[model samples]
Target: MRYFGGLVHAIGSFARDRSGNFAVLFGMVASVLALGVGFAVNVSQLYNAKSSLQGVVDAAVTSTARDLTTGVIKEADANKSVQAFLDANSRAGILSADQIVLDKLTVDRTANTVQADVHVDLGLYFPIFSVGDMKRVAASTTAVYSDKTIEVAMMLDVTGSMAANWWAKTDKIGDLRTAASGAVEDLLDNNLDPKNPRVRVAIVPYAEAVNTGGLASTVFVEARYGSNVPPPIDAPVSVSLTLAPDKCATERKDKDGYADYSPDGPNTPRLDNDGKTYLAKVNRDDHMKTCPKPELIPLTADKQKLLDTITDFRADGVTAGGIAAQWGYYMLSPSWRSAIADAALGAGPANFDKKKVAKVAILMTDGQFNTAFAGGRGAPRSQNAGQKSRSNAEGICSNMKRDGIEIFTIGFDLDDPSMTMTERDQAKSVLKNCSTADTSSLKHYYEAATGTELAAAFDEITENIEKLAIQR
Candidate 1:
């Protein structure tokens, strides 16, 4: 009976020995629950921060990129801009402290764009179960930059008619000077490089003729003299001092309607002295700060000299502008520039036609060329292009002006002297069409009878040029 009582006590003691199993089971279940809650809460917060950071970076980079294209901001400025943007967003609580960092930033000036990579770090927020502080990282960003120069040319008319109020306005010549001076100042103000020799100018002065009359005339005449006068339809031939290998003297008409003959030297009718006024340079303080060397030789061929020549002009002669137009074309033609480079007659040939540099020409006149007056008596130009000295000055200006040269034309004071607008419009049309682009690149034609309108015409032309420089 006693042994049976001992067995019952042992069974009761065994049932109470479950302490180790309960502890193990409770620990496992607690660990699993904490892990699931921590993952769900912390991971979701990290993901939300990452998305917000990406949105902020996208906005910042895009804003900076646009500024680069206008030449306002540079590639070097891009990084600073991006950093500033990020800082602003962070201050707004769009980002966490010390959580944002620049992963990488690259600036490429050659391509004009800046590229940036950004990183964001997230910290654990919920502490329901303090397993550990978690780190969540996300990457985002990009920004871009741009810089470009415009091409420009100044086409000016230095024709004689521009000097006198030949068209009835305040001296067309004065108007031209006013307009061109204004243009240069505007260009300088707008950042054009006169020294860079990039922005160039070509002055074309047309009259009854283009007095290659100075040193050029001296040389050309000595080499070129005609015996059998070209027909009245052709450009009148210009001769030096007339003295045929077998003839007597060279006779020229004076403004007073008298003919004097010269056989050479100071004795006969020297082509050097005309009965009317002579060509002289007048570079007053008003001119564009007299250009440098080779370009400042108006004692022969300058804006002033050309203007003076225009002033000295006589109405006795008919216009044979084609020859003058041809010469102007030659001035801006690559082939001509190359050929004349060695001729080196008027100005410094260097700046005139540097390799790869652009060429330009301006043709201005008031007449349609009905006659060509050779310096001699009755040896008039034939207004005829086929047989004469190529009476097609308009055609010459047209053909060559189209290639690469920028051309402009001004028809002053004539009310359809050619009997129709077609003749006048032809050259002007060619000029306008051959301008650099479409609008600012073409030529301008102005008609002025009163001084105010003529001056206004000049102002209008200059304004167009200024507009081109600014736009370009």
Candidate 2:
């Protein structure tokens, strides 16, 4: 009887023991931690899937929009384009490739917009505590593609400065040609239709003077001369000199005594005080030496012709950026449509609607605008032409911008190694002033320090132009 009573007391004491409480509490805490960790891991995976899906959607919509803007793909094909892009990029890491679904694609031709919605079923890495094994993640993206027609006027500087051999193991002018041509190809590739392309390009190669070549007679008035002996009517004699007819052109002056920067049709050709037409004359020494004689090629979609003209360019002449800028503006001006047509350059657009057409000028120069000469065949060079040239260039830029023409200025190796810092700063300042204000996150000014850099700058400009072309 006593043994039985002792066994009951021991059982009672064992049931009241507090020494084993820590083990039970630790077990409960561990269970809760495991569930929390599993839920967190699954949530992280879902977040990652969402991010990946969003990226795919964004890329697909952007590419489709670009192709649509360039007319590479029709609205009916937008869904195909997006699906193809997604298929090419889809992987089996965060999101299953086969689970990706293009929920909807909407294309508004009139609005020039492309929108896409995509959904993906993502399998959870750790489905714990009654959570589901899979979740549906979705993403939507929209892109607005501009349908505006693009007209580009490339005003290149073929001055003597471009011939400098300072660029390490590379010719500056050659680099420029390659870069400019590459830009042309990029802007027009897959973006043109033979019947009605959305893009057209013009080239204005300028030096101390702009050579009109075969188009000179059509644009300039008859040449006249002034002699030492006074004529019967107290006027200079009308003399015909034996010279190349397609050699040069006189600068157009504004009626307000400022540089004639307005693209208001052809200016009345200047005349000497003797009522004789003034002829454009180059320095006798630089006539054939430094003058780039390529006539300006007006707006055209002929890629081969444009490339050929750029390749055939030879660096010769003084930097006349103002004249080049003016010519660039003229190429896009509605007023000069008749002149362009008469010269057979190309049929100019009937009208310029800022909403439907984008007029852009790419002005590139390697040196300061420091040369200006009088109109006569052998007129003396101006003493203070550098300042005047800069002033004239700024005036032209202002006028062009006022007309809604976008200007992009490039200073290629403008900092002469042998020149002073002040001079280099001045050159850069001139180019900066000539460039239009930055708009839509696109900068209008660039400076290249080397030939490779110059080429890269042109390529960057080309990209910006392309983006601008497809995005309003």
Candidate 3:
């Protein structure tokens, strides 16, 4: 009886001891806490990886859509393009490129959508209830895109200053050719359709005046050689009476001088000079020859024609930005449709329909506008020339914006050391004021200081225009 009691008492004492229970309980709690912490870390990692993956997929699909719309890649290559982009950007978060899998890619031309689905198998730090050691995070993205018809007019400056190099260390004329030509090629690439064209570009190269080409005789009022014979009403006094060559036309004296009226509506005034104008005094070889060499190429899809025309552009005469602006407007204005038709150019300057078409203008200059026209002759050869020209350009810009024409302005090397601070500021300000206000990532104003930057500016503008065409 005593032995039995002693054995029972010892067992009871063992059960009552709290020291052993504490260890066991602590072991259980530590295991649970470690698992909870591990699971939380895995969840955070998974969330981050998923978010990163989603961003990559979104960018890939959007880029693919843009390329498809721009004809940079065909429908057949879209999947490949997206895959390449994904592969390149897969290492975004804690995820490696090797872990990402492109599960599906769909390019629906009928729907104008590019869709991509991707997944990443992320190794977990700890396995949780009802979950494996790895988590499969998936992401899907789609971009909708379509092309719209666009009309663009580029107003290029061929003023004498373009022949001189500024801070850019390269001749502006040479750079203009490269930049403008490249832009044309990019803009018209696979864009021209015989049945339904999507893009048309007009080149308005301006100096002292715009070369009207075949329309000059029809639009220009004849002025007999030698000046002082009743200069057109409001015409400035001539230092020399010189005549615009056969294909050149100056400002209009009629009610439509600053207006975007058709050439048929009002005849442009005559510019007659005979070595008595300020141009004659300047002593520059081409100063006496007032007309720019590059004629206005109306809205056309002929890329090669445009390339050739600008390639032959020569820097001469003074900056006549106001006249050039007016011509740029005419190139897109429906009112001047007949003039373009009469010139044997294919039908263009389509009637304004904001919903169906986008009209855009790009005006580029390297120096201040120092020339203007009254009647048919140059504006008074004084400081008023610069002010008048800038005012006229801005006025035309306002009118264009009101008419739904989007304007972009580029000031090339305006910070040239040769120009006064005031002059540079005025030139820059004119361009800034002329441009359509910036919106989103599209900047309507650009100041390119070098030839490379100049080319880039053109490329950027083309890209933005392309984006506008392909709205997402």
Candidate 4:
């Protein structure tokens, strides 16, 4: 009986010895397996989410960059479109686009790029997993392909009043030259263009009267001595050779010695936005023959001619922007390429050639147009008519735009005019219709009350140009 009891006890002992050890081993194995499964689920979900949404970001960004500077679309509204695309398509692939959360989207105006940030919260199934959450952050590729040259035309105001401290602390003439040349250097120094043509610049200095170069000096000079056209006209100032006999004189002997050929003539001509006069019966299309050599002197060139030309600029005469605007139009007119084949500015025509180029003019002025020939070759003396001149100049600039020459007109430091407010307002009205550039690009037209503002304005414009140059 005793022997039988000992056998049973040994069997019980063996069973008890292994029970606790088996339980411990099973727990350890289960915990390890649980963690492995959890991490696998999290990693797999995150990887799938990133792969799917990365495509979404790329597509959205590429689409957004297309019309960045075209003005075809407004920015605020465009950004909303981008945001919606990213957010709506956030959840898209195996893990689901919804799983990938959109954080924010931004469109940079000056940089011309679209960027988006997002993250995915990976959900894994494992109750005993050590960490409950896993996340992955991602960013979209920056998309704005900038690789084009910037084109610039510096149109400066060289009026007589520019000699006066008309623009705040600075005089008009010096101020214009300083501002203009500075803007030029900014473009060249930064090398705005990443493409072959590079940023090309032209300096157009003008006043009440532009320097009329004779054909002997510049090809733009028309046959003067033989032709009936008199020397360039000057601004209308109160002089001894007046148009009216003065309210004080009634002798009516035509004492001023200037011919009165019916001052304003029969009708007011209707010049369209492109300087195309529907009423002038005379075709001014030949005006392209008037583009002067412009004394190349490129500031961007390694030589110093451009700097010399700018320094030599003198402020004289009244403000006659009409001639300035007209020539600006002609310089960019493709028709002139043939006319200037041998002229100093012959290359100008090619540079502005229509078939293979985009033409833009930047015209800056501080005064209104007050002198236009009406009664035929003399000062307008009857009643002091300034509105007509302003209107005509406005018409010419506007017409230039219609004619396909992109114009950027700057109204810089305009002072109170000698004429009524109506005349001043009439002149101000011209700038609104200036420029063939898209409304979006025209935002670059800057008004500087102070010199610092002028520099900043220039910087802003160049920055924008750099961004959009990709498509030049």
Candidate 5:
């Protein structure tokens, strides 16, 4: 009895003592500290997971929206497209694909938007306090998509140098054909609503001059200045003015050349053959002329016609980039719609409004712009063709850009060992200065060293165009 009572008394005393109070308080504080640390850790993990999920979802939504806009997939297939994209890229981030659960996908046709909501049950590494073992991390993204009309004028170079030598067992022109054809196909294929096409492409192949083809008589100012053919019935020929042939069109004399004036305003001047200005009408199919065999095809949604035209492209004459750029502008210029009425679509190039339509010009070249007409005199194959062509091209491009035309320029084989430093620089300068500056991933200027790079560049440009069409 005495021993048991003494033990009870000692236990009571120890329990009532305040000497161990500090240790007890320390244990409680330590537990709270551990819980706070765990909570912070879990919160950090969830934040990271949420951020990663949002990125992936944004990308998936944007891609799916593009697919919908391009008519690559229908409304019914949008969910699948988004899910597939999520699956492919989900693992690319911090979270695995399996962790992500696509909660819902909404395709609002009226709004032309694709919105995706996704969530992930992230297993907590440290479950502290009253919180559960897992937390839900969710993300939702919306991308606006629309089939805004797109008009692209591709200014391709068919200069003699493009066919000069073989690289990678194929000449530059051959490579150009392949690259250009592929780009056209990519742009026009599976065109949403063929009858009311969303995209139209125009090919403007040029060398020493742009072959006006059937429209030559309408747009070209024929030779006539007391030195040759008679002037137009309405307009009198200037006595001081030299004359040019009616085969191919060259740069205009004054500001009208750089300006995107209608054929009704001031007509384009004809190209002069060699040093001799045209005194009278010459054979339209004269092989001695600097005009390329391939004529400019205005904006059309017909994919086959475009492909055929590109396939038949032949390299000839010297580079006349300024004249070609001018024609490219004309193709997209709404004022010149009547001039190209027969060749282009019923609507022609859509009004130069970025909101209603996207007008893009793709200027490509393999060498320097060495050919130009001095007044009405032809200056073909000039070793020192000054900055005339480049300056004119830049001026025309500036006008196009001011009118909301997005320009993309490509320089193929500019790094060729055979080219002189001056030649390469001049060729690259015009292309560089012509392209529009872009804030996105796609650049407006591309330097393609080989055919493969050329194809890749075109592909990238096509992607840029598609993205450009999609807003928000």
Candidate 6:
């Protein structure tokens, strides 16, 4: 009877003992913690799956949109393109490829948009105390494809400095030609269409002056004679006397009733205060000397002609970047559209419409603006100028930007061996200021130290242009 009583007492003590309470409490806490950890793991997996699916969907839609804009594929092939991209970038660990479902793939031709909706059934890493073992994740993306018309004016520097060697290359001019041709190909390759090409390129090879060539009479007020004797004021001169073999043109003076940086028409004659013609001054003895002989090619979709023009580039003359920049702007200006049409270069829209067209100017220079001329009709000549040209360039750049023309400036080996650091900095600063402001989506300035770097710069610009053309 005593032994039975002791066993009962021991059982009662054990049940009332506080020392074993910790183990029971820890067990309860651990169960909850394990469930929380399991839920977190599943949540993390879902998040990862969502991100991966979203990336794939975005890429697929973007690719489809680009292909559609380029006419590389039709609406029927958009689904195939999206599927192929998704298959190529399958996230098997986070979400099974087989479980991924493309719910919708749409191409709106009228809207020029591509949209995709995707869903994935992601298997949970830990499904303890969960409603289901798998979670559904979805992603949707839309991309707009534009078929806007693109006009590009490429202003290249063909000065005497281009004759120097470029990064072990035989000739810097040759490297420039190669890089420029490559950029043209990148932008215009497969761009031709029978109805209307999406892109047109114009080349303005400039040095001391821009060569208007056959378009001079159409665009300029009057052709200047090569001789020092100013032609009789208000008297008609023979076209032969006025025309020169090398079509180097001087910038019109501000006093000629033409705004300092405004585009001029034939009716607006750039004449002296006395209403006399201003002859194109030739500082050098050789008539064709120091001239970038390649005539400017206006906006044209003829790729072969562009390539041929690039191939035929010859480097000469001093650097007059301001004049070159002005001509670059003119190439894209709607005011000059009629001039271009009359010259048989190409046709432009009747008016400037930013919604339907994108105008871009790529101005490249290898040196500073060291040469400039002011005054005519036996007036005291102002020569070997500097600040005047730079200021003019800045004004022109500001005007072009104000008119909604995108300006891109490239400083190719702008550092002069003879210049001080301050001078070099000034030169670069001027060029940078002349370019359009750098933004998140667009880069307007580039500095290339070597030929390879120059090529890379051109390539980058071409890629940007292509993106702009497709996403307008």
Please, what is the whole-model Cα lDDT of each candidate in the order they appear? 0.43, 0.73, 0.76, 0.50, 0.76, 0.73
Candidate 2 Cα lDDT to native: 0.73
Q: On residues 43-88, what C-alpha lDDT tens digit does candidate 6 reach at each position?
A: 8888888888888888889988888776567678889999988888
| Candidate 2, residue 203: lDDT | 84
Q: Point out where model 3 deviates above 4 Å.
A: 1-23, 41-45, 73-127, 131-136, 142-146, 164-170, 189-198, 214-218, 223-245, 253-289, 337-342, 350-356, 375-386, 415-425, 448-453, 467-472
Q: How close is candidate 1 to the true structure, as a TM-score?
A: 0.41
| Maximum-TM-score candidate | 2
Worst 10 residues of 5 by lDDT: 279-288
Q: Model 3: per-residue lDDT, tens digit, 1-472? A: 9999999999889789869987899899999999889878987998899899999999999998877766566678888998899889978877786677889999876677988999998888777886888789999999976644689999999988899557546688999999999999988886635455678999999998788775553343334342222234344646224443456655543322322323222223333343221110111112224777788888998889999999998998898787788888888988677666876976758877765577899999999988765422343345376787787788778889988888989999898888999999999999999999998778889999988999999999988887666653
Model 1 ranges off by over 4 Å = 1-170, 184-195, 213-219, 222-318, 336-358, 371-391, 416-472
Error of 2 at 422 (Å): 5.7
Worst lDDT 10-window in candidate 2: 280-289
TM-score comparison, 3 vs 4, better candidate: 3
Point out where model 2 deviates above 4 Å: 1-42, 122-134, 164-170, 225-244, 254-258, 267-291, 349-351, 373-383, 417-425
* Model 4 residue-pair collision total: 14
How far residue 13's Cα lies from its native spot in candidate 5, in Å, is 4.2
What tens digits encode model 5's per-residue C-alpha lDDT throughout 137-248? 8899999987577899999999888884644455888899999999999999858678888889999999988877655644434342312222333343564233346447
Backbone clashes under 3 angstroms, per model: 22, 2, 10, 14, 0, 0
TM-score against truth, every candidate: 0.41, 0.77, 0.70, 0.53, 0.71, 0.75
On residues 203-249, what C-alpha lDDT tens digit does candidate 1 reach at each position?
33433333332213221111233222211222234422332221111
Clash pairs for candidate 5:
none
